[model samples]
Target: MTDEPNEIDGDLYEHHHIVVDAGQDLLRIDKFLMDRLPNVTRNKVQAGIKDGFVKVNGAEVKPNYKVHPMDEISVMLPEPPRDEELVPEDIPLDIVLEDDHLLIVNKPAGMVVHPAYQNWSGTLVNALAFHFQNLPEMKGNDGRPGLVHRIDKDTSGLLVIAKTERAMNGLAKQFFDHSIERTYYALVWGVPEEPSGTVYVNVGRSLKDRRVTMAFPDGDFGKHAVTHFELIEDLRYVSLLKCNLETGRTHQIRAHMRWIGHPLFNDTTYGGSEIVKGTVFTKYKQFVQNCFKMMPRQALHAKTLGFIHPVTKKKIFADSELPEDFSSVLEKWRHYIDHTD
Candidate 1:
């Protein structure tokens, strides 16, 4: 007996309602709304559940709440406020290789891979959406298209994207099976005692800071992470190490390097000392100061990526050159070496 309009005009001052029936029996709250409202997205549905806008039987419900044979489900969808929609930007891309099945691009730093809350435009997805005619849909609840894996927003590297559904499924399986060989180059603070070693640690959610992950000796919910590193070049004070990821975890390279006492330079989250000290301080004192001032993010980059092509079955290898900022740091360090020696 509600007089709510089926649809409202304007972007704001709008509301709607959806009734439940036996057909929706046992459907999760979020899934039910997605089916009922074609315009509403899964993320929007989840946000409504989090904001307590979704109620069942006159009670606020969780996202996983199952519907009965006969239930009253009320969903209040707030109109998006006035804002410019996603405008496709014709940004230049560094495409390494391309085929009908997949495309490999060298992602640059300072570019977001995909859009999320607050960041709706100017992402890699936006660029791809503009460039490509058809992009494969992502698996699971995340609605991003063609993105099988991800790198940090500030960390630049190589990324592989699928162009078709078959390619997406095959590539996603490669990531989960740890078949994708990814090698990263990092300029850490100090040299490790061993030239090459493996770090095996359990990475879990950080209890102190929810935003970061922490290593745990024994924890309830933790995943096994392994990183193998070899010292590629020793620049007197700083060591340039090449890391191969055995198991990909969130911030695995950054966290493991910090745990071993040689954090990457300018890594704020992993306790990289803003000021250089000890051997590094005395060796490249002036150069260290200049680096700390100029470099905004950690010195980490996915230098190499290798895998078997999902469709072609041919081995594919792609590499990215060191960014200008990282190369400049090495140049200063080389100058200090010459002066000190």
Candidate 2:
């Protein structure tokens, strides 16, 4: 029971409960939620209010409802409206592990995890639709079949998909509890001041620029996010980092690293596309441009994922080798660093 909202923790939202303070002033429920739930727009709260996902003392409330002291409030964020049915595609999936209850897919970069606006086709969900016959049996959060969690379209990684309802609930609880082990490899533009450290910060959507995420160092806004980072290699202008997520906030790694002035290399959204380091020589600029072309995306990959098997009650751990694009660019950086002064 709390008012804290994880604004961008993957696509899963938590059910929240709260009790009004003893001496609270009367305030609009929507505004109150907006203040408590950082990075959420007023309209979104109002929408949830309209959808009857928000209740006070077990009764649905209107957007204009005022809060009173001792009132018990509960809220559940609803999924966005789906305009079309998911269509299965013949896209090949690199399944790493599979059992009766669950399967782990090594998702490649550039593949959307589920159907959404502008990416309504050729998603991992679409492939799941094609591969499974018992579609009705695999429903998960937001009707995304078998999906317990997701990574970004450009962030390649391991994903565990539940094949049964029991599996789904079990895995979802692990994610909610933050017990699932997840680690990523990222090439950032600069080295951190520490070889290993944790970025304990709040990440939420920017108030001024809504398209990207911003860090709240003072915890003044957004959801709590923690990314543990260790410098795996220092390549002069760029560095290879191993990032372990303690809390899976939306853009946690990208935003947190950038906050400390080391955004993921070639991450255009986080201002990593430009050369943040290196000399202002024409040759250096050209070399970086070539590396960007070689990778053609952010230098981030989900390298390892581990969790307890939902039904088997056994531990599951999966690791993946770096993709060609990611490894090749690393080679380029390594060579360049060895050759340069």
Candidate 3:
């Protein structure tokens, strides 16, 4: 019997536990814990112990303390309430599916997921607040509500929002375990050399530019991220690809694809805005510029999402068609391919 203190925002909260087996050998508490937690650093565990957040048999214990069988361990940490309010807005939503516990939305490009600096209104959260009056209480970052996961503002597609605490925790766990199935469609600048492959690298915030992420191939920096991609259509100078995310980090698909030499079409943040392919003839340049004008954002969409139902344990899946801008751009590319040769 064991109760562990929950780790939240680098602070300990709700209780957790692990019962030692009868034949278990003595092990240091920190090392023992490091083996159990996923994606947690050893230094983090040691820090938790050093801060007296871990205890054995109702007594605070040191990191190096040896653990024996049947020791009841517990940690106590209180979670302070978040202090912010969401002002409901009347923005419209393109909801695809809704249940008593969850709602699936087909978010359009250019819509911010939640309120942020200079984006305090006209956000998805604001729209949701006005639509659902009986939302469950959640201490979200800066009072954002119901968001279990999110896609980038300019990259539109499907999103699943939790309506209750049970659903939120359930979906959050699925994301943490990387069990949620998500597929994205991207129109990139160049065709991948391989038909299908995976990019395994460390992705974290860029040191040179805080606004974007960078990949660390040698595992020297950042969090572990994996993206699997397959070519769907070859537009010669460009290609349409499907990307499956094994780990969802900020800009995982965008940054990883850029690292592999095929930045998403028109992704200005990673240098996709300028022409990277095709002829330099004035007519050709005008054609390319016209395409850019039609679709100004990155050509990436969250095409599909699948997860187990929080209430029924049944599988739930949602798919989204490309928005008009994305589809129109593809049609232009198809026409270009058909006639250019």
TM-score on alpha carbons, each prediction: 0.76, 0.77, 0.75
Q: Write the per-residue lDDT of candidate 1 for residues 64-146, one digit (tens) a residue.
A: 88878678766555553333344566878788999999999988877888876566777888888778856887755244677
lDDT of 3: 0.84
Off by over 4 Å in 3: 1-84, 137-142
Clash count for each candidate, listed in order shown: 0, 1, 2
lDDT of 2 by residue, 1-341 (tens): 44345442345343677888899999999878876654567778899899878889878899999999999987766343334567878999999998888889999999999887578898999999899755333332454788878899999989988887889888888998999999999999988889999999999978766557899999999999999999999998999999999898888899999999999999999999999999999999999999999998898999999999878889999999999999999999999989988
Residue 255 error, candidate 1, Å: 1.2
Best candidate, TM-score: 2
Lowest summed lDDT across 10 adjacent residues in model 2 is found at: 134-143
Better of 1 and 2 by lDDT: 2
Model 2 has an lDDT value of 0.86
In order of TM-score, best first, we have 2, 1, 3
Off by over 4 Å in 2: 1-83, 135-140
Stretches of model 1 off by over 4 angstroms after superposition:
1-57, 60-87, 276-286
Give lDDT per model, in order. Answer: 0.77, 0.86, 0.84
